[model samples]
Target: MGPTLATRLADWIDELGLTDHLAAAGLPSFTRDASGAPSWIEADGEPLSDERLAELDASLRDHGDDPAHGVPVALVLLARKARLRAELLATPAWTYDHLAEVRGASLNATRFWVHKQAEEHHLLTVAQGEHLLVPAFQLTPSGDVRPELLPVLEPLLAAGTDPWDAWIWLTQPAGLLGGDVPERLAADPEEAALVAHAATRLAQRVTASPKPRPRPAPSPVPPASGGCGCGGHH
Candidate 1:
């Protein structure tokens, strides 16, 4: 089954290690109802303060039936609950224009939809400028996925391996997540072999050439005080 809103929110918090912050904030942990909709409440079983509850209500109401919108809102809630200002600033979810470009869709409709999604998910704060930035987060560039792996993995996705499997295979070996390479390889034998083979080929290609020699040193000039003029001084 596809990831649920609660699961996605939990994953972001757990991955970023924000549990302590959430506890400190006194926000209730996220939970889902039988219908698969996510909800939260205060730890003391009392409703949140008027202002805070209103903010949360606004976020909940704004989301207007788009699955993609869940990703950003869950992320935002986790950030707010955990007080993870730094991480929030780091991954400002893609803006409306960014979504349009990536999805190759109409600008006006895409922006409206994206805005609705963000509102529903509570993923962003007030929109400003031409783009909306994540309230407290700043996004950094994720390096390109290894070029060789994309070809291999795209086919697997097309053929239909679970997305988590695809995500793990594409990202792990490149040390995107860092840590013991061999351990990761052992965990997934087939993918590990593919990555190793690709890496070996890439290495061989790069090292096959000899390093270029340094350019020849320039000739030195005589000092002005030297007696090398046409007067024939010895």
Candidate 2:
């Protein structure tokens, strides 16, 4: 039998050197009960019961003004780390609801946490539309390509044909186009060579195209005007 998802994630976390962060946050390295549900060890070496963990999980969903009401900031950070690790191992395309269902968390909270981590790592793009959490390589009004597609597109584009055309042509069956260029090329070696040559030319054109400049970073927000606000103020 294959390893469980949580175990795979734990291995990835260790590989990424995130276990120390979890330790600093006073959470266990990673533990699995007989039922395979993951739980964290407390600072005192006692295992946190599922019921208690569920309570802490619920607390994170509450947006109360009282900072004391939610889970510890550190725990939240560790949870984000775990979620990121899980995402990295997941298939290229997964929606926010999909991840929430996997992690057993509220959709809103899961979306916020996943987006925040994704932004920090720049691992993937997140888009929200019609109340769905969409993960893609490029964020667009319609939808983004799966993260895995970017690498495929990049190499295909660099080789000289329009990436989209290459994508469709390469993926389509040999005879599906009937007597069209692709179909004819598939039927003859000489024609296939010519088609490959044409693809190279297109890739050259795509590679020669100038890339757009990146946008500037946003300015930092100013502090509130109420005299430093906290009790540390004079």
Candidate 3:
């Protein structure tokens, strides 16, 4: 079994070079108990004792459907997502006008067609604070839609995978690709069929899962109407 969170927390405290702080705070050196769990955060030798960890894990699982179940953990998760979103948006992207130019479509008509493609799951769209973005990974350097992307995106999009989640899946290493990242693998003609199969299997798993859908967070402000200024046509 993997290290328990209690154990991992102790390791993180050390890994982050916080052991000195813990020492300064008059706490004993961080160490694992007999079962490899951390010697509890307080109470001398048992803060997150096995019983407490079990209780906490059970509580989390029991209220997994509740957004407010674990406020601190949820906040940490949101912070991590925000970081990922920022990094993803920092990459090259395309605007409707740009895509239209690449496809020889009417510049003025791009907004309509691009939105339509998004609806059909033929395109991926990310809505940031005040903008919509099409991360450029989906396009060739010459700005045409990458052929390998289409077939793989078909099943994933059809399965209702969230755009952000789809991007994460595509960018992460896949066992089916022998540790090759999916988006990177897309550039290889020899691996096209393999990537497509992996995406299909991913979609199948997504469709088959019985997990409860997360409650959508309400956006405090309306999304900006115009798309990204990516093409420099703004």
- lDDT value for model 2: 0.48
Candidate 2 Cα outliers beyond 4 Å, as residue runs: 1-165, 171-184, 212-216, 224-234
Instruction: Compose the digit string of candidate 2's lDDT tens values, residues 149-191.
Output: 3433344444544323453444433333343544234336545
Regions more than 4 Å wrong, model 3:
1-80, 97-106, 211-234
Q: State the lDDT of candidate 1 residue by residue for 1-234, as single tens digits.
A: 986445555555455565445544444455556974545556654434546554543453355575334333454565553343333334434555564554567779766654564444322233334555432221123211223343343344334343323333333344432443422443364665555454444344435646657544434555568667443000
Please tell me which predicted candidate would have the highest TM-score against the true structure. 3
In angstroms, give how far residue 139 of model 2 lies from its true place: 32
**Could you tell me the lDDT of residue 143 within candidate 1?**
17
Ranking by lDDT: 3, 2, 1
Write down the lDDT of every candidate, Cα atoms only: 0.44, 0.48, 0.67
Query: Predictions ranked by TM-score, top down?
Result: 3, 2, 1
Candidate 1 backbone overlaps, count: 8
Native-to-model Cα distance after best TM-score fit, residue 230 in candidate 2, in Å = 14
Q: In candidate 2, how many clashes are counted?
A: 6
